[model samples]
Target chain A: MKKFAELLENLIYSPSTNKKIDLLEGYFKSNNTLENGYALSVLSSNYKMKFIRVSEIKSLMHSKFDKTLFELSYDYVGDLAETISLFWKSNMDIANSKKLPLLSEFIKNCENKPKKKMYDYLFNLLDLSNPTQRWAIIKILSGGLRIGVSEKTVKKALSKYGNKELEKIEKIWHGLNHPYNNLFDWLDNKKPEPIIDNFKTFHPMMLSNPIDEKKDFQILDHKDFVAEWKWDGIRVQIIISNDKVVLFSRNGDDITESFPDITFFSKKNVVIDGELLVGKNCQPSSFNDLQQRLNRKKVSEKIIDEFPAFIKAYDILFFREKRSSKFEFFR
Target chain B: MNILDSRLNIKPLNIFIDPQHPVEKAIISHAHADHAKSGHDKVLATKETIDIMKIRYGENCAKSFQVINYGESLKINDVDITLYPAGHILGSAQILINFKGQKTLVTGDYKTVDDKISTPFELIKCNTLVSEATFGLPIFRHPNANEEIKKIITSLNKNPQSTHLIGCYALGKAQRVINLLRDSGYKETIFIHGALEKICRYYKNSNIKLGNLEKISNLKDFDFKNNIVIAPPSALKDRWSRRFKNKISSQASGWLSIKQRVKQNQIEIPLVISDHCDWNELTKTITNTRAEKVLLTHGNEEALVYWCKQKGIDAFPLSIHGMKEKVEK
Candidate 1:
């Protein structure tokens, strides 16, 4: 019955309306009648999943209103779940409180008095059964909390939590954004493996208006500053090292899904920085020249050459394949 | 159109991108490449614009650009000209020329307020206000910047580990975000996308106090727990976010407020912040300028002109090749 409700809801919305669309669809597919605010708790925990949108639910409700269960959920879910779906943003506590009142009463009175009004009021109303429930509140308060707490502040606070000097942990916090999941593994080993270099890092443009610009760019003395064409194409970093090929943003993200062909080449480990430009004929072209390929999740063999992509390699940061490797220099 | 015309003439040439090219003094408003396209290697703007042109386009392109600044009057053969800040992007200026005693304000893509990117657009009183309505429609009204920033701060506060993947025009957007977040109360490490960090450093070296933001290129460290990460929209979604499974994303853009889905789709959240003036601001600015006539071009200029006409203000969107027009579906 719940699966039927979800499919009927799916018929009304797409993944674009709300990120929560998927999670809600998943909840309904579980084929279970929710008990004692279990619906709100599950959806609240859906933040562990994703957010919900009232507009999406509204569309679902509008069509499903005639059904007995759709009409019945209104009593159990209350105004909070409806609020999030309509506003494109909402408090999980508020949604949870709509199901449970006494808990919401406690939070509104104490823990979150001066700072967070609405969130506190909402959390006080929900079912708080586990100590991990604190993670739940912190998650909603922290915008869909997932994991790997922002270790910078956590590093500072770690003096209390993990009993370590703030500065020492901060050093390790620097590498916190790295891709490897086994974070402490690098520290645990004697010869810690070098970070995977295959991911591309972006360098955001710090542009200057001509009127406010300096007399000239302070060139990093010829050797230090190697200038490239500043290709009109988009900037992208390609990392291929440790037998792992990944594309990362300057923000340190792996974009291997977007440009597969760029990584499909040579199975060896190498990290190179360059522009992701789609060329015409053989030369790099204007930024608009590469617009056609921007959003494609995966490029086909035809696209590989049709745009005839090329990167004007300006910097070489990691290459186990080459002499004078960065690892040897720094370590 | 073959993309040629001579309007309110000035030192460095400015483009209006009209199908029906007006034959007037070719007045160059400012030095941005979008407004400063050239023909035959000889163009006109202000001394400042030409000076800027030299720095950006080089001597060849710069040598061809004519120079003119505010109030430095010169009759380029037959066209009389003047320059003032347009404030749409950086170094932008509105061109005002008195051709045969009839004044026309050629606003080459303008904004009303001063920002980290550039100065506020100057008010110009003219018989005919020829403007690029980048934010022309009534719906394009911009909100109070301070209030908007406050909302941005709240959104950030709500999401502790949010990586603000702001969509920038690359030039101005990056600089604006850096400037806005420079002294923000949040003391987390602010990492700039290497490209943005470099550009921001240039702005700082130029004497603008853009606060201290660490460049991602040099600093090989970050803890998402406290720092604010700024990147273009393209890198925020897809594979760019895989490394950190918990990071939330948001875009700081004028369009963000209007197109809620853009924020919803690109990142988990959206902050309605932008460098461009919104429809309300544009209308208010045009009305306040009290220019007898208004010419609008760019994003929904027709709709903007219609709105102005409804209120009994003479306005119309000039046909131009700005990003919106060229990139429209």
Candidate 2:
């Protein structure tokens, strides 16, 4: 946990992208399966330890410290977790617990505990830990690890050990749970990879760069480039394999439930890349029309009929061996 | 009668000095935003304070101006008013109101600590004193400011390859820190954010020698390593700081005295420099004023009021909803 905390601190301060990747790669390389898996959960903001909140910490602190002093310190610090980590008074020796508990062990203890019991458990842990470790614990429980590590970046680091591609990691990512021991064993080539068919998972989609204004058309060959209208609607990758369908935004978030009207496609193990549009007929509508159906859990029938879902399929990748190389959207 | 209520309850003399709301006539105690507001029909302040008001709120800050200086006494509706140096900022002043042989003092966000750039606070003998308690608690005893400045120099000397990004308030703190850096024999050019450029220019126009200062927006491909860059606290944490390679974030504010504040701000180094009076100075100022009664405004008023009562002075907390404790910035 200390090493992971140190890694997070370093990653937060390390400005260069290369340095951040190196730090994460070094952490993943040295840590064990459980540690690396839990570290991944925290860095990706998916840690599931929500037995405590910032308000609870503030109230607990108010009960312990002077009210005026606490309020002044809170205003000055501008962060609740950091304020608690720095000012939490403990009578017990912090060094009594010589060896810090493992991340998995902490999470295991937090499972299904009542709010009161969890508060005591967390208070004990906090007392025994240093400021940095305390900050890490609070950040994990609060689940807003804005230390700049994206889910894609974490997967990218994990792929380095497995000799696996990003899509393979993303495909199996959602199917696994916390402390991914089985995934680690498979990555280390000690066991076969676990496969969960018909489960919703995300896939990294193809992206395009802005056109360069300085490049001369005379020197460039038109045959090598494929030009398409730049649609304002959100880019989506619809993955349909084994009668299971999931719609992924460009950032690799699963939006399958938002546009359920377009989820009932054919059962081919293929990934279709296109723009998520809205309107009747084969022609496209404005992006404003599609905005009505987005960011919603349950789309009403009236809205579905008024702004009907449509996908302007630009390219398709078959689930063949070389499916990664088959992206011809910008060919 | 309360000094704050005098602006409203005292009719005929509808003159407000540092009133929270816009009034027909406002006597600004200082150029700090909370004290000197725009939309006043007439403004009475020191020349420097009026200039600062113009810089902050433009020429339309007041319809008319009556510029007063330190020790200059004026009569406003049978009340004798005088401005004294508050030493909080470049143009900050304390208003001393004398009515019918009774004197009441309004110290608007003052500091007694001696500063290199701003005027030092002068104690005024009065019957009653309304003091700001921005750092009123007993625990807020500030350390030696010179020692704080040496810390920045030492950090720069140690991390010669990293640019030390000093985060400070744009108005007074930035100018004061830069001037202190100059006085400490830091000969290198200090890069500044665009937000500090106008205030820095104002400070320089007032003949405060800020040596070798340049705005970062003007410099292209400039070497920031081993250089000092002063900016607003907000800019140092944002994407703007990414332009410099190997930068260290340092906040130069009195709030940095707290370990929690230092950690929360993500500051690598915390310089405990302030423009407001600390607990000791606040007590010292009250004692030196020789006032029979004391009125507290802003900060932990209740604690200071209790301390005053312990000293056998008639003390009360002034519940001025219009006044803001100028903390940090």
Candidate 3:
């Protein structure tokens, strides 16, 4: 946990992308798969583990200190775990060991514990572990582990050892779970790669680059260049696969519920990338109409009728595995 | 009661307290890097502080160096000034200035607690007092230096297999911790990084024995077991620390009273050892000075100002636009 905490600290402080990649790679190479996979999961956006709140941490701290003093410390530090860790009176003789439990074991022990028990557990753990390790445990369990490691960068770290492209790991990332033993086994060449079922996963979306003036236009032949009129609406991808329709934003965030009308397209095993506007006609509508029904967990029937969303297809990446299946987005 | 400026050189006297900018005549209070800046035309400080400045910026730190002693009075122009022990560091002093029968005291950085090294703080009666509030918040109650050192020693005994990398400011804190550790009866030679060589040598030259000090050079040959290494805080977090196979990082600062900072720096062992006065000391010093007016500088000024108002003492926060207190090393 100390090494893992140090790795997180290093990653957080490193300013350059290359340095971040180096730190991640170094950590992954030195640590076991359990620790690496958990770290990756902590970095992922889907993980949500709030075993204890800052309020609870504060209450626990009050047990050991004066209430007003703890409040002052909390206000001064501006972080819950940090305030507790700093002012925590430690009896150095009480089961203090340089060795800490593995990251996986620590997480497992924390799960299913009662809140009162967890308070004691965490207090004891904070007493036993050093400040850095204490911070790591609190950060991980509080679900505030934002060290700037994107999902793709994690796959890139995995790619370094396997000699595989980052896309290969990203393809199977959504289907796998944390502490990815099978993923590690495949990367280690101890087992074959796991084949994820049909479009159940999110393929890392291909991003467009800006056209450089001098030579980009020169290399592009008139026949090869395909220019579509750009729309001001939110860019989206409509994935129709495995008898299910899923509408994803340009960044691969699932937004199927936001545009239920657009999910009924009569297509299967196909992913079409396009712009989503709030109009039914072939012409694109103003982005103002789309804004009314966006970023909402639930859209009312009246609003949906007033601003109906539609998608205008621009490019097709995968079509039914039988026709044009062997397509590479980057190449 | 505007004495030495907390800001660098708004007035010429600021150069005396903060010598970042040169001035004609400067009366320095202490030898902490923030207070004793290099490149001054003329510096008037304690004899020990001048020695520390000479070691830091070389013998030519000032065009003319005048050594003053505690309780000694010196007259420059129409100002009558006296130096008093602040009990902050080895050569720390509080300046007492009197002009036309009114007295004002400028304390660079001070603490009431006895560290058994520097001269103890003596109360100086003045009409107005300018004080440092670095740990002025009521939350910042520093633990005893001896107790904090015992924490380090206990950890060292517990984790004998790992090297302890103690992070501190090179000039004062590194030497203070080393002295405290030596006084705790740990006879082993403490390893020090190259950055601390100059200041550590200065302490040695001042007749302070730090007990079997070794300079860390070749990592491959250095022992990693049951050893304590003192280096600048920057060295603790940088690639320099990776050489120790089994190492624990520790930071000694007043800021360790705030936990998030300790965790943010990734310090394993936090020693709440500080040279500046904590909240109680700040208030006590204000009361002890018998000052009618108080000026707070640096840390948690607003809170101190508000507290002073409730106590019926005229107080204000003396802040400069671009001046930052040198809390971090």
Candidate 4:
């Protein structure tokens, strides 16, 4: 926990991307696999556990210190987690005697527990942790690291650590769970690559890079390239296989829960990449109209009718359990 | 009996303590610009502060100068005024005014912790305390100077190919940081910005042992890698720092304790080395003074005032000029 806290602190202060990657790589090199995996999950915002709510934390702080003083500190700090971490005063002797819980230990202890039990566990853990550790714990509990590193940055660090291509890691990233022991084992060359048997799992989407028109156009043949309308909508992958369908965003986050209307497809074992846009009668609406149907766990029937979503297929990566070649699809 | 007619002036004597505007008679607290201004007809401060003012504003900074050493008392009208070390910068003093047997100490930006370059702070007991609340809120807990200094050394060791550019205030903070680096056994020649050269020379002339200093402008085609350069905060983001390749921008100030402030300034490395007192020090000093009433001045005065009222002490936030100016320096 101390090492993880230090990494978060360093990442917050470090502004350059290269320095942030160095910090992350250094952390991965020093920590164990389980702890490193949990840290990565937290930094990437993939792991979310609301063991303690902000209101509960506020009540606990009020119980511990003067309400006015806490409010003043909170106003001055402008961050609730940081203010609570700094204002929290526990016996240093007792706190130092007990070692802080590991990132995995904390996660497992709070996972699947009742709200009251989780609150008690967190309260005691906070008592044992130092200011920085408490800060990391609170931030992790809140599920937003906000440390300026994107999920892509975390993957870049992992790539640097394992000495593997980032594309390879991204290919199997959505299949891996937290505490990725097998992934680390494969990276360390102690085991073979983990196989994903689930046919509905997301495949890494290929993205385009900006081309220098003057420099890049000179070497390219006009017949080799295909041009399409660049839609101003979110990129999504629709995977439909034997009795299963899933929708994944470009980063491979499962968004099947958000758009149920788009999950119904023909009974074909295929993965198609396309733009998810709101449209009417074969014409796409504005990007703003599509945003109303995004990121919702329970979409309303009214919204589904008002802003209907459809996928404009850009390319087909897989069909009938066989990967389609890029040139073949383009032709 | 009213002690102060206004926030800046002492009643009955018509003397201003650290007044922003020039006046006929001014009792300057320290040489910091907000507290010590030029064009005052008569200026009363410690000898070091007088010299600093002379260096900053030239010989004609004031019509006449009255040097009051620490612990020395001067009688003007019915009030007897004395000076004590504030421990903020070299020659920074807390003005102690004794009027009609009532003592009011005006702390012009002070810190309780010893910076080693300035005189150690001496807590004076007074009936009414007029304190500067620059770091008045409880969130601003400045870490130890040695520990914060160690961060720079650690970062330097980790990235040996990069130049460490530390942005600090030109006058006092720059000198204190240099002294701290020297104390930490950093034996290399410390490079300083051109703006810092004069004040650093002043500190050296005052018998502060800042070992082996070199001006950045004097050297040409120098390898700045694995080296530390101290500059004014403005130079950190400006073209002046572009000369050193792969430079990491760091800032040493109390405001760096807040994460948002560091992010807003885009400082890559934040060192929480303060020249003013933190929250604990401010509250402790207020309580230790045994003062019945407190007049809070400058930064976050509202919080300190609320705290004093809770302690059953009469406190008021004094709305003085120059309150909005940055008080970290």
Residues B70-147 of candidate 3: C-alpha lDDT, one tens digit per residue: 999987656788999998888889888876677888887888998777899888989988888888766577877887
True contacts kept of 3: 0.15
RMSD of each: 21.7, 9.0, 8.1, 2.4
Q: In candidate 2, which residue pairs get closer than 3 Å at backbone N, Cα or C atoms, i.e. clash? A: none
TM-scores, each model vs. reference: 0.47, 0.58, 0.67, 0.94
Which numbered prediction scores highest in TM-score against the true structure? 4
DockQ of each: 0.01, 0.07, 0.16, 0.65
Q: What is the interface RMSD of candidate 2, in Å?
A: 5.1
Q: Per-residue lDDT for B279 in model 3?
A: 81
Cα lDDT tens digits, model 4, A147-240, are 7898788889888988989988887777777778888877777798877644657888778889899999899899887789879899999888
lDDT of 2 by residue, A207-280 (tens): 76666667766567888886788777889888887787778888777788988788655765777778888888
How displaced is residue A63 in candidate 1, in Å?
28
* Fraction of native A-B contacts kept, per candidate: 0.00, 0.00, 0.15, 0.59
State the interface C-alpha RMSD of candidate 3. Answer: 6.0
Q: What TM-score quantifies how close candidate 4 is to the native fold?
A: 0.94
Predicted complex 1: CAPRI docking category: incorrect
The lDDT of each candidate is 0.49, 0.78, 0.76, 0.85
**lDDT tens digits, residue span B102-141, model 1:** 6767677666777746667778777777666554433333
